[model samples]
Target: MTNTLTDETSVVLANDPHWWRQATVYQIYPRSFADANGDGIGDLVGITSRIPYLAELGVDAVWLSPFYPSALADGGYDVDDYRDVDPKLGTLADFDVMIAALHASGIRLIVDIVPNHSSNRHVWFQEALASPRGSAARDRYIFRDGEVPDGTEPPSDWQAMFGGSAWEPVDDGQFYLHLFAPEQPDFNWANREVRDDFLTTLRFWADRGVDGFRVDVAHALAKDLTYPLRSHAELEEMKLVTDGSHPLWDREELDEIYAEWRAVFDEYDPPRIAVAEAWVEPSRRHRYAAPTSLGQAFNFDLLLANFDAGEFRAIIDHNIQSVSTTGSSNTWVFSNHDVVRHPTRYGLPDDPNRENAISKRWLLHGGPASQLDAERGLRRARAATLLMLALPGSAYLYQGEELGLPEVADIPDADRQDPTFFRSPGVDVGRDGCRVPLPWTATGSSFGFGAAGAHLPQPAGWGSFSVETEDADASSTLNLYRRALWLRRDLQDAEELTWHAHPSGSDKVLWFERPGGWHSVTNFGDAPVELPDGEVLVTSAPLIGGALPAAATAWLRRQAR
Candidate 1:
């Protein structure tokens, strides 16, 4: 494979049967990507219009966050119809057209599948509400009689992932479980109809030319039948339990479900695939990524790592080892719709408990306290991007990361829409900051995101980081991404990564070499470091006196010894 970019077309490497292994995937949050109709919202047409930009970005595939028909509860994660597109997004016909456009541009399309739950407005859920407590319709969901005779209390005290009780009472007096929002009811995967429906849904999309599916909350589909009561202390500990011992999450039953889904995916000519959004422990992740189940599971350790070289190297090594056991590729990700942008996170002071602080109200405020030096953050983010791309597996890039977009932490409360925010009020800032609409132009009503209003507010200074601004600058983050991705094609089939030891034995810099003399060095310390003897190909920042600057990364082709 040779790195080549011609007329905005990426030409490199023959296709591998396991293309996802070492593939660069870009995630598009539909409503925030682009708006072609100027309807104050982004739609399928908005994405279709940007297919050229995506191909130009040099990504192998584009994974769309749920654009399915929904009540906008949980940002479309609460799906109402699995087979159709949301009218606000576009019709099913529009989705088909977009699929064709993406494939035409040498890109694969991956859509999100929220199998764990459905909108309360879904027909099955509505029927469950209308039917008697013990009726067949009610059986499709986790409906149980209330704890007391009056049925006033929920079946058991369980907390929703967003906030509040997991159980919602209906007029029929039976309580149903929803691990997320009340509008998003958890389905009874135990029901034969529920399991079969998901298989059909998989086929529906696979038949439409979608290359893959990003299964939302993939580990939460199957729950313990007993619905055991868990104490507050146990609940807190459950969040960190990766052993799958928790009653509700990472249950063994999920493996069977994925196997069935994989079977459906295998029916296709090229064979479709799925990636699990499972948050289970690293040791248990292989079950989800096994060849018989989902082909890949997102390795979020990188997302949770602090801006330290040692921490990142450890995470990378562990993820690669874990995924290898399953004969699957390690899926690396830095930022996604659910968390704060990596640039902002890297800028903030490192706290040992930062993971737990993600949902805290003070962190969500997105105030001065929530931010640090912006320039420093961008430098580290750029370096991180290079490090991620140089690794030997699939990398998921959130939409605006290429442009070095920061979190819009100051989104006004009234305009906030994440269920996590409303569920807890001012206590938790929610995920809206990272979900703000993207900017294409340096100046516009919504930074050219739409003709007029955008669903979420865009910060005033965001224009400076817009694509138009970065695209013109040769040294901009956007260009770095473009060049790195173009170069990445040559390393796609690389299966080994050997860490290079610094002569000074410093832990502040990460050095690694791949096959074909491709080496990457990233400096996470305060001082500059000497680069290995090689031809410098590209860098996250300019070299200072031939030394890799602090918070910078340099890719090189090793000189013959």
Candidate 2:
């Protein structure tokens, strides 16, 4: 690498108002990140203690997954309070300290905000339960009268996004809509009271010094008042509707709601910002990231792509062009709290017999884990990281991927808590595997996650991927990330991408150049390829025989800016 990295390099772009556009944001799932209390779970104090580690990795921001009060029905997304922290996670005082610690480290904190639904334990939902039907207390949530003579059945055939029916029946013959678990009741955005409460929630966090927000289930906030009856297949097709006619998502009313959010965000001196976690179609996603709205949308097309050059190339080009119209940067993610880890996913065989591209199934026993090419998987994953970081948009890293940690994939059913697992009746194992506590030390009861055993089981080989081990080895994935992130600061000046020419016209090899002479070359094929002519800055793997090996990526610089 031509440039030497210093601590000051991380804060060079801190003055930019749209700092998130080309930033590296790391997602920390609080319950599994670190446990300062040693109670078999992670907490706010744990996250605050790790600020130096995050700063060393060079992430511009840290997106903390929900630490709010909850019964853990849906992995903390089932928020019980919008204004305070969960006692198990930490108290409000601890949260305030964590915010200060992150900011002092030059790392902005983006808290998770769940607007579409709230825990059934929330005061408003409990009030809806205590009050009679049609009362003002019941107006804040989506409660409707059941159809048919008996009123025992739900209002419609709608199903939950996790599993089972979306509508749950109450004792009074009234049914409330919950697009997710029954424990999380959907808010009726049409209600003035519901809208007003969320506005207050935004201001509350902003006042607490949160730099921004990562809005959860952003697309489902507004639903069709007239719940239409349709099969699951028909609902999937409706995602492509350009007119926002989907019964449960992407309604036209979302623009107005986000505009209100943006107004509150702009009230801050640096201007608080937000990124939407909407899974709408690519063409329709720009609306969520418009200047007047959240200002950024997660582009998950990379998560759907297999280990191939053509797929990655197409997705990169299409996403850049798609989001360019809005003048907002696209957010690229491969793994998150909700899905399988990318290394394990890339380890699977390339075939149609595998789970469908949309929703793949990973079993805890006798399933996809039985057949895994971990070596090739980690190789491809590292290569993918260079590709993602060198792109024209922002990049997001899941909690443990910096150490190249593979999916646990074998957590016992008895310890599982994901609603997806229980709701699906064990046919699907849910996300417990990927949520295992991080290994901080090579020798510990729970790999330094906590004094007690992790709430989710960790594998016997957990120590092999511990932070202590990775930190010692120069060739470790952790080093690759630390080095790559430092080099990535130079790539931020250019926002448009241009594909580089490959001497041999092979689709399996991808070579692209950004506007500032920063070129990234990736070889997804099973053969070594000659390196392009330039000074080698960084590479995913060591060069063999003066050529880039298979499943590796290299960043070459023709000249400095």
Task: Give the residue spans of candidate 2 off by over 4 A.
Answer: 1-15, 227-237, 351-358, 363-365
- What TM-score, computed on C-alpha atoms, does each candidate reach? 0.95, 0.95
Question: Alpha carbon lDDT of residue 369, candidate 2?
Answer: 50
Clashes of 2: 0
TM-score of 1: 0.95
Local accuracy of candidate 1 as per-residue lDDT tens digits, 506-537: 89989998988899999999999999888898
Worst 10 residues of 2 by lDDT: 1-10
State in Å the error of residue 465, model 2.
0.5
lDDT of 2: 0.86
Error of 1 at 481 (Å): 0.5
lDDT of 2 by residue, 132-220 (tens): 99999898999988877878888777779789988888889999989999999999898988988898998888887777899998999
- List candidate 1 segments past 4 Å from native: 1-15, 239-243, 354-357, 364-366, 369-371
Which run of 10 residues does model 1 get worst, by summed lDDT?
1-10
